[model samples]
Target: MRHFIARGAGLLALVALAGTASAETVLGTPLAPPALNADVTGAVAKHFTDAGGLVFKDLKPSKARGGKGYCGKVATAADAPFVPFQVILEAGAAPSVLLLSDADGASPAISEENATLLLKNAGCLE
Candidate 1:
């Protein structure tokens, strides 16, 4: 009984932590930091040729041209010893950029993903 009660309390704490964590944001709102992408199929295929990630391109709401948002895609490594992953970095509706990166080396691997996710959670995916 005691053990079960302790586990339940721990789970509750974890839930609380998750709820608070999702609220953190780097950029303010609407406006996002910046990203890269590939607007064409050829470009998307060539994306991340360097490391193993993609880039975002062609942003929306062209304040200069008109419209709004961003969009894009990602490609995981084809070889082994590397966990294939994807990165869709967008400023608004589409990913503004994409690039190839280490699958699971260290912080760098998930660094951008973390940042992007943060911005998304903060509603900064503009």
Candidate 2:
């Protein structure tokens, strides 16, 4: 009876560890752009304007380490709820735009449909 109980506990621990690992994998690491490109910058700007109806001012672009692509920051409007966002651009991958909020910046507040449309307009999605 003791051995069976121990085995059951061990199996439960393994199952818990597996669940954690899968969750970490699902929440993938964030990507940073390594360089700047005119096309990508234009695409991001256009996406923000067309989708959110918000114009990005004081936009500054910088090259990310390890030559990934470009990373940039756009000034947030005073009336907006969310803070200024950080945008990441990669050569062949979809652009990752993060809205830095006090609650959780990793998960953006934008709707799924709007996010898809924004990405599509930015040429990051097909």
Candidate 3:
């Protein structure tokens, strides 16, 4: 009886851990701080190759369905119009960048599907 109870307790512990693990974000439980300058510049360069004069601003720690990372805005200049952006940086994983809007009603920098997913994960959408 004692041995059976011990085994049952072990099984219960394992089940509990599994449940919590499934709730954790696959992108990374607690994402790492992004190399703001380098990462943001690289994202801009990659996503908006022909664009220029863009600057990153209002960066702050953010936690969302996607994971924990940084959220901020990109603007053409200090006082220029801006668009929202979310960057998810994780060790050993490629960085994820979501350029939400063009700030001029233009199409997004990335594909529609990707933009939507990022927006949802970033809690911008329900």
Candidate 4:
């Protein structure tokens, strides 16, 4: 009985180690995700714009490409609740996406549908 128990414990340990072996991580390295939030997506666009010697502020939406949608600068309302926000939307078969860069100069926020608009109205998406 003791021999069997010992063997079982060893096998369990081996299995656990094998499971962990397949896991990998990168430390202190920046790898961009396929889809990002408002802040990250804006940063990515800025990266490309800066690389191309184009002013980020002057950037405009081209058109929807594939499953992606696009948005330009934001319009602020004085009597509103949310912040000024610039956003982009990408509509695909999966998730309808929205990206917001806060024009309020506070923080960038990401949301879907009206949530992004609400954040914009709240002045969080800068």
Instruction: Report lDDT (CA) for all predictions.
Output: 0.28, 0.33, 0.45, 0.28
lDDT of 1 by residue, 30-122 (tens): 223333222322223433334223222222332211222232223333222321122233245332222223212222333455434433432
Off-target runs (Cα >4 Å) in candidate 1 are 1-43, 50-68, 76-95, 99-110, 118-126
What does each candidate score in C-alpha RMSD?
17.1, 18.7, 17.4, 22.5
List clashing residue pairs in candidate 3.
none
Better of 1 and 2 by TM-score: 2
Candidate 3 lDDT over residue span 5-118, tens digit each: 222212222111111111111122222333444553454444553345555655555454334356666665657676666665556755555555532224323355555555
Please say which candidate is ahead in lDDT: 1 or 2: 2
TM-score of 3: 0.47
> Which ten contiguous residues of candidate 1 have the minimum total lDDT?
14-23
For candidate 3, the lDDT comes to 0.45
Q: What is the lDDT of residue 86 in candidate 3?
A: 60
* Candidate 3 Cα RMSD (Å): 17.4
Best model per lDDT? 3
Candidate 3 segments whose C-alpha is farther than 4 A from its true place: 1-36, 65-68, 102-126
